[model samples]
Target chain A: AQSVAQPEDQVNVAEGNPLTVKCTYSVSGNPYLFWYVQYPNRGLQFLLKYITGDNLVKGSYGFEAEFNKSQTSFHLKKPSALVSDSALYFCAPPSNDYKLSFGAGTTVTVRA
Target chain B: EADIYQTPRYLVIGTGKKITLECSQTMGHDKMYWYQQDPGMELHLIHYSYGVNSTEKGDLSSESTVSRIRTEHFPLTLESARPSHTSQYLCASSEVYSSGGAETQYFGPGTRLLVL
Candidate 1:
């Protein structure tokens, strides 16, 4: 079964500081990874995805992720954290055969 | 801009009530999916459709049923609502490009349901 794992439940960072949210996955074949953010009372907004080619993928809101094949990890990163960036983040792995499997999620708190 | 829309942005209903959540997309995507999510929690796929008149259950077991009568419309119905069904339901659509799973999904605002 294809699954995704987000190790941290929450990550706290000060405004203007760099931030990182870790993610790993287990799949039988090629993996299709994605990052999504959900604001309060809203649906998830797609941030980025890694299908093939580039190992380092850039996304919306100045977010980026690095796909490591050997470690099976695709961690999201940002050069500088902003207060507006505080939200719930989810890492998902596409099953293609059925649906996408999401991680438990990680809450990012950007304190100003 | 092209988008997916879900109706009844917020709903609080009593148990045993039959309710249908409507989902429509204008992106002309062939695949659509329904997901259930609790507050500040992970998203679990409840159902999905490949195209019109095609539907399949997802990883999560759900009492709600869905139908895809039109290419751009997929509606989910709950025969009898329960307290456990109180959660946010998200509707998404994607255009499957190749068999390698390179499709990107576009989501709607979602419907928040509260079964009292």
Candidate 2:
């Protein structure tokens, strides 16, 4: 069973500042991870994914994540944050049956 | 953008009313999934289909039933709606790549259901 954990429940960042959302995984073999964002009353939108590729995976809206095998982490990062970036983010890894095992989710608030 | 879509963006119904949530995808994806989520919360997979007529229950125990009569359509039905069933329903689809691995699911706007 592959699982992901998001340590923070909420992250607050000022506009134009950097933003980071941390995620750690527990898996027996190769790791395939994904990041998604959800706006209020909307379904999740795909951010990015890592599947046997480069450690640094870039995603939508100028966001990127660093895959650290040693640390067992895939953390989402953005160089500069905007108020519109505030949303709920999730880190998910596929379980044995190809179903996504999603994290508890982290709420991000980018204040203007 | 993803080609998946869900109907009835918002619904408020009385308890014991039977309802069906419709989901469709035009991207010709082989796999489709239905998930239940509360506002600002994590998603819980309720049902999924590998293809037409191949529906499976997910990790969460749901009172809803799903049917995949067509490759592009997967609809979830609740025999009797209750307050506990009030939540947003999300539909997603993904294709298996040539590498035999599926990743990066595309999602719909989701249907918000409120059972009074």
Candidate 3:
């Protein structure tokens, strides 16, 4: 069994400011974590992933995520946010049966 | 680039209307999935395919069914769509290469369905 949680339903940030969307996960074994972004009425786009090694993983659109094993968290972060970066973000962990389980998703609203 | 495609980007139909949502991926991925979501909210898996001629229902008990005949095509059909079925349908395919059991999935634009 694998699961992910994005506690915040919505996050607001100003342009050029750093933004963080928190995520946490639980799995019986090793977890394969992922972050994805989705524009309005569009499908999910892969952003970054945490497979192994480094805890900090960088992704598309100048986004990055930190994987904290002790905290069991993989939080998405951006050094500088753009208004265009406002979208829905999802956290996922591949389930034991090869299915990917997704979080409820967090909507990030970047204001210019 | 991911070449996954979904037909009927938006569909509006009355209750009891039967419809099929088409999904095709050119990435030659063996695993394909169908997810039902309410915009930026929760996602529920409806169906998935391991390969051609291999389809299975997902954790969510759905009233729809899916078929995978060709490697690139996976179509979902609803015998009678209800108001509850009015949601967005997203299709995705994954390739397994990364470590720690990571498999990156590429998604299609998705089908927005509304049942009247």
Candidate 4:
């Protein structure tokens, strides 16, 4: 079974500052990872995914993640933060069999 | 943006009442999934369908039943709603690309159900 862990429950950052949310995974085969964001009372919105490619994968909204095979991590990052970026973010690892294994999720607060 | 949609954005129903949550996708995806989400917890998969006439239960033990009569439609039904069943139900869909083994899922706004 593929599983993902997000250590932080919440992260607070000032607007225009860089922000990062940590994620780690355990999978048997080649791991496929994804990042999603959810606003209050809304379904998750797809941000980006890493299928197989460069260690660095860029995603929507000027966000990017670094895939470190050795560490089994795919951390989401943004160069600068916007107050609107505040939301719940989830890190997911694919089952490869089509099922989605998601992390508990981390709440991000970008203060103005 | 993702073309998936879920009806009854918010519903308040009493216990023992029968309710159906509708999910539809305009992207013509081959896979559709239903998930139950609670506050401060990870989303739990409740049901999924590979295609029309195919449905499977997910990891979570859910009393709700689902049917996939058409590729675009996958609706979930609860015979008897309960307070325990009060949660947000999310619908998502993805296309299986022959070459790419990883399928990216697109989600709908979700249906929030409150069973009183």
Winning candidate number (DockQ):
3
Predictions' DockQ, in order: 0.64, 0.67, 0.72, 0.70
lDDT of 4 by residue, B32-89 (tens): 9999998657899989989999999998999999999999999999999999999999
Point to the candidate with the largest TM-score.
2
| lDDT for each residue of candidate 3 in B43-100, tens digit (9 for 90 to 100) | 7888989899999999889999999999999999999999999999999998656453
Candidate 3: residue B86 Cα off by (Å): 0.9
Q: Provide the TM-score for each candidate, comma-separated.
A: 0.94, 0.97, 0.95, 0.96
Kindly report which residue pairs in candidate 1 clash with one another.
none
> How many angstroms is residue B78 displaced in model 1 relative to the true structure, after the best TM-score fit?
1.1
Q: lDDT tens string, model 2, B1-116?
A: 78888998999999999999999999999899999988888788989998988999998899999999899999999999999999999999999776434467999999999999
After superposition, which runs of candidate 4 have C-alpha atoms over 4 Å from their true positions?
Answer: B99-101
Chain A agreement with the truth for model 1, given as TM-score: 0.95
Error of 2 at B97 (Å): 2.6
lDDT of each: 0.90, 0.91, 0.90, 0.91
Model 2: residues with Cα > 4 Å off, grouped in runs:
B98-101
Model 3 has an lDDT value of 0.90
List, residue by residue over A1-112, the lDDT tens digit for candidate 3.
Answer: 7888888999999999999999988777677898999988789999999888899999998999999989999999999999999999999888757788876799999999
Candidate 3 lands at a TM-score of 0.95
Estimate, for each residue in A24-65, the C-alpha lDDT of model 1 and write its tens digit: 999888888989898888888889999889999999999999
